[model samples]
Target: MKTLMKRLRAFALSGIIGVGLLGSFPALAAKTTLTVGAAATDVGTLDPHYATSTSDRTLVAWIYGALVRFAPGSTDPSTIEPDLAESWQVSNDKLIWTFKLRTGVQWQAGYGEVTADDVVYSLEKSRDPKRSAFSADFAAINKVEALGPHTVRITLSRRVPNLLGLVTNYAGGFIICKKAYEERKDRFGRAPVGFGPFQTQSIVAGQAVTLIANDKYFRGVPKIKTINYRFMSNNAARDLAFAAGELDASAGLANKSWLQRTTSIPGAVVDVFYPAELTLLHINITKPPFNDIRVREALAYAISTQKIAEYRGERFTRAPKSVIPSNNLGYTDNAGVFPYDPAKAKALLAQAGYAKGLTFTMLSSQLPEYETTAQLLQGQLEESGINVQLQPVEHTSWHQMIRKDLSPVVIYGAARFPVADIFLTQFYHSSSIVGTPGAVTNFSHCNVADKQIDEARTEADPAKQVALWQEAQRLIIQNVCAIPLTETSQVWVHNKKLNWGFDLKGSMSLGPLVTEQTSFSD
Candidate 1:
């Protein structure tokens, strides 16, 4: 009874919006509501730990606050700023990191203050493989302890100069209330509560998730009182709705047709963002056949960037000049590992005892871009005497199967900030091997330059670290662990009135964050 009273008092203090019905949004005539129609079929998961898609990340942002966050509208590693942790310090050895939290931050559903215990608990869960999919990233933390009610000390296993970025928004940094989660383990993913600017109101299957502004938010409650995040999977329907003014914003692919149609719509803006993501085909070295470097090289040589560029058709992105995008930090302009040469590919295959050509099935996601790229690759490989059968799996299942090492050749699409260490570690570190013990996303299972990667991350000197990171990428490209495909384009079509607070350079948020500044100008 005492515990219940405490909960009720805290709930009253939080100032959460009251709904007459459970799992239903309340009718509010005076509230400002924003309708967002996205290209996702559903809001994937509210649990920050399991979220892997843009839609999932968007929802997480609405209901959870990170320890640190990227500068508004930017995914650059250098722009990391404090969120939950007001200030932090690093010991001279650069191993011990201490963060001081702010007081009076209340968790949704009246769970109480955002204290050091919550941060420690959240980080602990992130490190536990049994609980989080991102355990590999958290494995870098040697130890974490709560110093006081609002202080946290973290000891790193390795000196990571950009440790702030690693723990920022996307790469597993959302702090959660421990008791609230423990009390609702079975419904955790479906219903997550965090000390964020907004609280979830309802999640209607196959439709939308509604959120209400947290009136007691530390940063001041969001001006937009309500948001309906609609899952509009049909591109045509989404576009039509945008024309009809049923949506404030909609997801867009970098294509000509979208431009031709959207340009004429009054009060609509099509914002194109770049260096968005890398598309790559992972070569599983531990698996048979591709385990041989020559076989991998042959496959790389079999890829034709020009052919792929032509096949993709849309101006969405360009064939990658290197594993890292042109603008990415530590991107060295060396000749790409493989030039398109069918003769060279054939020669390598012949030397590798695959002279008659080998056949393999490549697993691809059902997303248009993934499936399209897979088909184009199939054609390119066939031209080089390699026969590839394309198997299209639904998006979620495809991610699951690829991580299990189900396909030796897995076509993947991912985005990391311009930081090369992040890109290299997630895709090549020995510790991150998928389907292995405590695995995360090292689909290639390549350890060719692990030492260089580790050294780059630890080198406090910025210039030296960049050079080392460049060297690491060179080594991985040399090994043909994966073939760099293209960087996809990002386009967001939104109502002109919704002024995203920052300059529209790029967005990590599926739709850039909706803040008090994101108001309807009209």
Candidate 2:
């Protein structure tokens, strides 16, 4: 009996030792799997053309290819290196552009070779009034035609120097499978087919999305076979999952507490990329009380952007004085429009006939940074004798409320682009406000109309177009349609064991993510 008991103890101890060894190196014990967490509140349509939100663009980029891609170090936003297209040139007149497509690129759906016809078909579908997916962006294109199987020609209605930049934009320009669209036009947006480095394996909306390597990708198959995107409604949960070893990387690590907690763990790193977007308070100028320019100017001076930046720490940049940041192509230092003056704010309020002080609610979502900024602005405005209320709502509800023209003031952020043209055209252009959220422009409804903004749309000269855009910015700031607060940096948290390289300007292109530039350490 003693000998039998000894044998049983030995067996139990061996099993325990084996388990301990396995626990010591989790990476070695299992298949290499990477899980990324994102705080995506809404499920977007899969069709790249129809995707409107930034979160949806993040997913679409992985599934599609653009004709030209922005080179990593290129300072010119308008200059793009070839992707699906091997080479491209513009006519001396700068109105017509021709592209030579690469040979032997296959769509994911086993469709025949991607031809110029596919490019023409994709652009036409995007421009269809019935589609309404990305019509505003492509409205300037007069026509797109297939010169041949390998050559595609695009003619613009006007001289658009930044046409290539527009083509690289994630939402509207992704190449789709012509055959797949013809057969599944109704559901194509739900399940898109593209020729990208990564192919969609499966997606469970608002839960997780899985992507597998595209073996037949033209650039080359991605080294990583699988990429799993897990959705978390907020940063707190995402940070917890990363610390617990369930997630490898996450975006929107804006919370300081979460960053502090995660960085404390071994093998974890925090990367602070340049401000991809800016957060600001938007006032509805189309409505009453706010219609008065004095009231708008008063509100701009009443809030302290510096305080908001200080509270947020290094993650936030000081609110830019101009609508476009200095880093943008046509950014000009225009401080005259935005000056921090409490007394001036008070006087403006009185001038606007609110000597007793104006009271209004500031709407924001559950984002901690936004909520904190709103609270700080509330305090600052109160100090300036303006009564302000901070109204916090769910993200989805907030989006809905803003679209209905119900919110007087709301806190919002928009991702930056290479050119100021994209900013002015999308947000301030009259046509853009019709169907979109208008958050980029914040539906500020400024009266300082610009025919130049319209003329620049068809204008193709780079220098001339930039001059027009600068004028638009000048007008926008002069009118004080929306208060520019701060340019907020994109904070990404990841395990140091994984390697990834992303541009300072956040790009929807997945080349950086797929090229093994982003990898994991053993």
Candidate 3:
């Protein structure tokens, strides 16, 4: 509740900085600056641990560092490389791990040097549910102890499917400056400090968040001196802003029509990147109508994943192979899905005593991806005698409302660390059921696959782990916790002058990443 209040206060405080005033803080002649038009009305939070929105996550990666990180433009876990920790060693049993921290790494804004004590504090904070939205991801950690001023050791209660994934520069893996956080406390959500290439300079609430280059960055000093991450929720407005040369880069719509329209712009390059986000329709089984197995199965039969993929075009979207994303380890189409058949759907509804048809209201997001996906499902389900009324809300409100269990069906789309265990646990494990203690987005209140998910996380044998994950997916599908829809790749349009310092491929943050080598030239 306190966190919610803090967020509200931050938003309220944001109205003070008018958008027009951004011109007053231009970069020096020798330094370069870039303005990006993001698809958001405002930032949810800047603190990496609680940054869930794409807008916030995009900024989090810039302003924070983790023990390790996915290589620039890469989502593959095998590309995991050192960030704050110079090197690490793991015990043969895989429970105990020790890390050697890089010496003399400076923190942003005089926060002092990064040390083992800071790493230990950050890990503990990541483990505390009150401090982190991703605490469940750290449940296997027994403790983090500082062995020396520059060394830290982590002991785990049991082996996690991917320990490095948990500690990478994503989600709760972002390391925080202990002194800065302790000093800021609850206010740290808006004012975060880290050791990344960029530092939070200022936030103008509904307008933009300004970031300045961190000269003391360990990798190297960033070439782009300033970043103006502006909030332009309207697609047309963002496009216009980019066309007017007010934005160097902007978030792009995934549909082919939008792609064709934007590609004609002079010097505008559209980057459709890897590791597509998996969209799903999560049915709250505990809710009336959905509580009946026949009704749940009817929903599966009525919806068409192929149609959803086709809506966005195959170039950037594809039908998901399983409830788990195709790019994820252990993903298997053999889990089995109900084919789209209106006749079968109608029969199932008739058997469930709803022959006349059933009507239900769904609280969905107005965000392009979600709004379109929900409308598609609603139209398709209507043919099978299932009437869905969409109560569209803004993106932020939609996220909060669904977590309150107000939505019978949640149209959620996300890209996590390409791992099956992480996806299955957060979406199907009983422990992750929303509105409960330690919840992490189990919107459906799914519990059937909890056993398999738990066993798979601790399974040491590679083949056995894969089998357990496959079994879990099969169970979740049979029970109809969620119907997998389309997997859509991220799309963004950037100016030709912007150099990202790496070949852009994929980002776990679901957006482009700016690093020390990033710069702009005529």
Candidate with the greatest lDDT versus the true structure: 3
Per-residue lDDT of 420-509 in model 2, one digit per residue for the tens? Answer: 766666556665553353232436655453576776666656688777777888777777777877776666677777755444344543
Q: Encode model 1's per-residue lDDT on 307-380: one tens digit a residue.
A: 67655445567777666666667777783468888899999999999989989888777665676788878888
Give lDDT for model 3: 0.89
Kindly list the per-residue Cα lDDT of model 3 for residues 121-175, writing each as its tens digit: 9999998987888888999999999999999999999999889999999999999
TM-score of 3: 0.93
lDDT of 2 at 19: 85
Indicate the residue-level lDDT of 109 in model 1: 86
Q: Better model by lDDT, 1 or 2?
A: 1
**Runs in model 1 with CA error above 4 Å?**
1-31, 306-316, 325-328, 350-357
Question: What ranking emerges by lDDT with the best candidate at the front?
Answer: 3, 1, 2
The per-prediction CA RMSD against the true structure, in angstroms, equals: 11.3, 4.1, 11.1
User: Which window of 10 residues has the lowest lDDT sum in candidate 1?
Assistant: 14-23
Ranking of predictions according to TM-score: 3, 1, 2
How much lDDT does each candidate structure score? 0.79, 0.70, 0.89
Tell me the lDDT of candidate 1.
0.79
